[model samples]
Structures are given as C-alpha cells and as structure tokens.
Target: MPPHVLAATRALNWLELVTETMRTALEALAAAAPEWLIAHVDEEWFERYARRADDYRLPDGDTARTAFAVTVGRDGIALLQAL
Candidate 1:
C-alpha cells in the first residue's frame, strides 16, 4: 500500500472511532477538542477534490484525500494526524 493510503486509513479509522464513540459529529469534535464543533464537509468542495485526486493520485497531496473533511466550526481546533 502507498504510504498515504496507510495514513488515510488511519485517519478514517480515527474519525470512525470518534463518530461511533461520541454519537454526534459535534460531540466528537468536542470530545477531542473540548472547545470545537465539526460537521459534514461541503459536498461540492469534497467532490472537486475527489476528482483531482482520481486524476493525480498523489499520495497525501491534499488533506481531503487523506481524510474526509470534518467542518470544525469556530469552536473546533485543527486536528492533523501525524503523517
């Protein structure tokens, strides 16, 4: 597997765990950051990135490819997983 694939998988797994354990996406962000809110990403932006990723396929070229965007509201903090 590509290095980025492994990283993406890890991020996805973490997100799943957060969502599962926290119940609400908002809750997950709060649990992880205690002061933030996060929600589903904008569909248009996500799809645009997905298209680019399919053509370029640069491992870890962009954040979206590594993990689905979680719209961390003003309350949330940026959580970047170790790459």
Candidate 2:
C-alpha cells in the first residue's frame, strides 16, 4: 500500500480499537494536536496502546489507552486517550 493509505489505515485501526467514549476524547485530542499524526512518507512506526504501554486519565475521570503512537526521529507522539 502507499504511504498515505498506510497512515490512514493505521489511524482507522487506532480509532477502531477504542470504545465510543474514548473515541470521542481521542478525536478531540487529534483535533487539538494535528502535528502528532505527521510522519515521513516511508516511515512505519504506528503501534497499539497495549504494546506501547502508555495510558492516561481524562479530566472527567475516564481512562484512555494508547490509541496510536508514532515518531519521526526525535519528535515522538502518542495518543493516550483511547481505552
């Protein structure tokens, strides 16, 4: 598959892995930090929350797992808002 397709696939997978409530929270996060999704065209660094071992708690007291994670060199970002 192509790079854009791969990124889209990985992003969908991340969204699918979470619950409805978590998905809403993650969407908000994604909207706030668009740069977190940017990566090199040839890079393959997306991973699930469990394997990444990153979790976070929202202000509403709900927990969110690591929906997706990626890094381009030293600028790494993780979406820890999908349970």
- The numbered model that scores best in TM-score is 1
What do the candidate models score in CA lDDT, each in turn? 0.40, 0.35
Off by over 4 Å in 1: 24-83
lDDT of 1 by residue, 1-83 (tens): 99999986776555444433323443344467643332433334223232222323433434753343353221123223210
| Model 2: colliding residue pairs | 65-82
- Clashes per prediction? 3, 1
lDDT tens string, model 2, 1-83? 89998985565455444433334444454567646543321123322211322233211211222322212211222333211
Query: In candidate 1, how many Å is residue 15 off?
Result: 0.3
Worst 10 residues of 2 by lDDT: 58-67
Q: Compare the candidates by lDDT and give the number of the best one.
A: 1
Model 1, residue 24: distance off in Å is 9.0
